[model samples]
Target: MTIWLHSEVGHNQDAKKEVKAFNSEDVFTTPKPERLLERILILATNPGDLVLDSFLGSGTTAAVAHKMGRRWIGIELGEHCHTHCIPRLRKVIDGEDPGGITKAVGWKGGGGFRYYRLGPSLIVKDEWGNPIINPEFNAAMLAEAMCKLEGFRYAPSEDIYWIHGKSTETDFIYVTTQFMSKQMLARLSDEVGSERSLLICCSAFRCDPSQFPNLTIKKIPKAVLQKCEWGHDDYSLEVKNLPAAPPTLEQEEPDDRPANSRRKSGKGKPRQASLFDMGGDQ
Candidate 1:
């Protein structure tokens, strides 16, 4: 075992001086010396190893890790994440910061970092104690969230108004807060055509769902709620683990044979009908 003294690993005063080099106006309170982090990382990790600091108060661990050629993730819940961490990390990445283990590690910074802001919870309770989508979400955000909930890739089409997401090249999803009428459904069905399938998530709809063979209509909050389980003791499985939606049906030219007659493909094999094609002749 090697004894580490302030002379080698540095102390609290040294930490303050390091931070003052970049941000002297707002010095961080509880910062660990970069040399201290360097010693710990050198013993516990190697170059390119991932280091995680959940309580990143002054971003010292991440800064030292980056200089030492180690990958790092720093999580700070306080406002200092924006004030101190980001500013300090920026200097380190640009090779502008020359304090702490910089000279010792020969760190001429050449790396980058990405910052992500997590969104608020999707489900929130109303005054009536009913679960509803958080009103904080706008139209595009709500559509993207719905796409994630339904396991579809969130890629809205510029030309098509209803194409908010897609599970495949032929299967698509649409999300709306508007109440869907039968006439609107007819218009959507004509637009989607018989060649492809669409899943509609709306606030409300009037019409027998069976009327549209190519569309699967589900109400918004209800569909989202069904995908989430409440007050369950066993946490074994998640609702997101549910099976994927069925594939789109292959449309054929108007068949002259009876509806019940077996349709043969060009390869001389019987073609299987999708369960979603119930309204179409099987």
Candidate 2:
């Protein structure tokens, strides 16, 4: 019942307007991904069940739900409101056309969703237009920011996969993009870090080796960056050659419906989950 795709778009710099990579006919730069909607629906709800998308990027969730015959509502606050969300959702409702996944899922498509926009990113500020700093930030504040920016959630007690003696709740980490000071590190480690954890660095290395006897340092993607020109775009054929967008594909209906239900042509019957997994909310 559910699936997901990445959030991205393929814009034509020359045109300034391009359909998204998944559904070229339905455009959105930061689409939430129809597959994510599919997976969510498959696990959480059934046909006629209601769904909600708080950060409705390009209304991908709404579109997927509509095509699946589910009632859905979306909340978003960004350029997508008109430039992307509305159009993408319209395409879904009309079952106009789409790429691979929707077609594969067999969406016969006759449903709709409601859209709404709330405010803005909580990290932003109002009229003064200046970023509000946490004057009294503690370990938690630093942890959350560091995690959010890096696409990881900060946790003080969880140990991630560092290859050294240090242990705490973290996978791999770095100081914030703005600052990577020892003071921040000390706070994160709860101060007395006689033994440092594994460290990965993109630039020059710092910190006294004696101070962190337990630390392990590993360079990442070692040769990938070195082989390419520094600091500029490196659209290697590996990535640049991806399909312009998902193929202009529509889903195919399964042939298992009963003849009486044939009058319905389809049922947005949400999918079932795999045996080994719990189908956690996407």
Candidate 3:
């Protein structure tokens, strides 16, 4: 014997009812019903399989996936990610949301999920074609991103700012936006010693490669300019029909400096890198 599943397992009204129970009002213009996701997951996946919802509107897919014993990932680009999805997921984890396929699926929730935000764009191009790091990035964030871009592990030294990361025990990477003179590079080469190598990324370096075979110098914005698209910053989908709003004080004249340089010039200590093992190509 064979069993056939109905294509229409849920209705829009059911989705509205589910959202209204938790949101107190119909905030979401359109939310997916948990039953629909349940049917789809049942057909396409098994317990412990991974499910991904890229545009997580009200997080119906994730909620259903969690209840169905599936590992899941959800991504939302708007503020609704925090305002709507997170609260809803919290309630789902605590078993407080009882309306959306909870009884049908025997979902008395007892699991949790983690939340993360994407960092600022790695590099942005100015009109002059110079590669400037995104103003939103901090020292640590920039260091970590550079490590990934250059094929190294982010491992900062507690006593050294230049030793931001390493590819091997003897090979390291240092990221800085300051101008580096030949004398400075020579000192760094001496510190690195003959056995190890150091890759220095700086805004300007007045030196020759022949002087220090163990030290490789790369100029910023120039070195990473051709790597990625630097013009298009916001990747989120926006409703084009909405009326344009006037810019606020903060938005009217945005600060283009890196996050750490908003106040005084070079105010605090630079951020030290941390250790993480991930693979990528330069």
The candidate maximizing lDDT is 1
RMSD per model, one decimal: 11.5, 19.3, 13.8
Query: Model 2 compared with the native: what TM-score?
Result: 0.33
Give lDDT tens digits, candidate 1, residues 12-94.
99999998886788999878899999999999999977688979898999999999988777888999888889889999988
Q: Candidate 3 lDDT, tens digit per residue, 1-282?
A: 143233456777788878777676547888878888998899899997768899999889988998998867799998878777888888888899998789988989777776768876677767896567777878788777777666667889999768988764566789888899989998888887776778787888886766887777877666676544455768554535422332333454544544322321111212222111111111
Task: Give the clash count for each candidate.
Answer: 0, 18, 1
**Local distance difference test values of all predictions, in order:** 0.79, 0.43, 0.72
When 1 and 3 are scored with lDDT, the better candidate is 1
lDDT tens digits by residue: candidate 2, 82-181: 7766766666656664542467578654554443333222232336854433345444454444333333334443443222111122223443223334
Whole-model alpha-carbon lDDT for candidate 2 = 0.43
Estimate the lDDT of model 3. 0.72
Candidate 1: C-alpha lDDT: 0.79
Q: After superposition, how far is residue 23 of candidate 3 from its true place, in Å?
A: 2.4
Q: What TM-scores do the predictions have?
A: 0.67, 0.33, 0.64
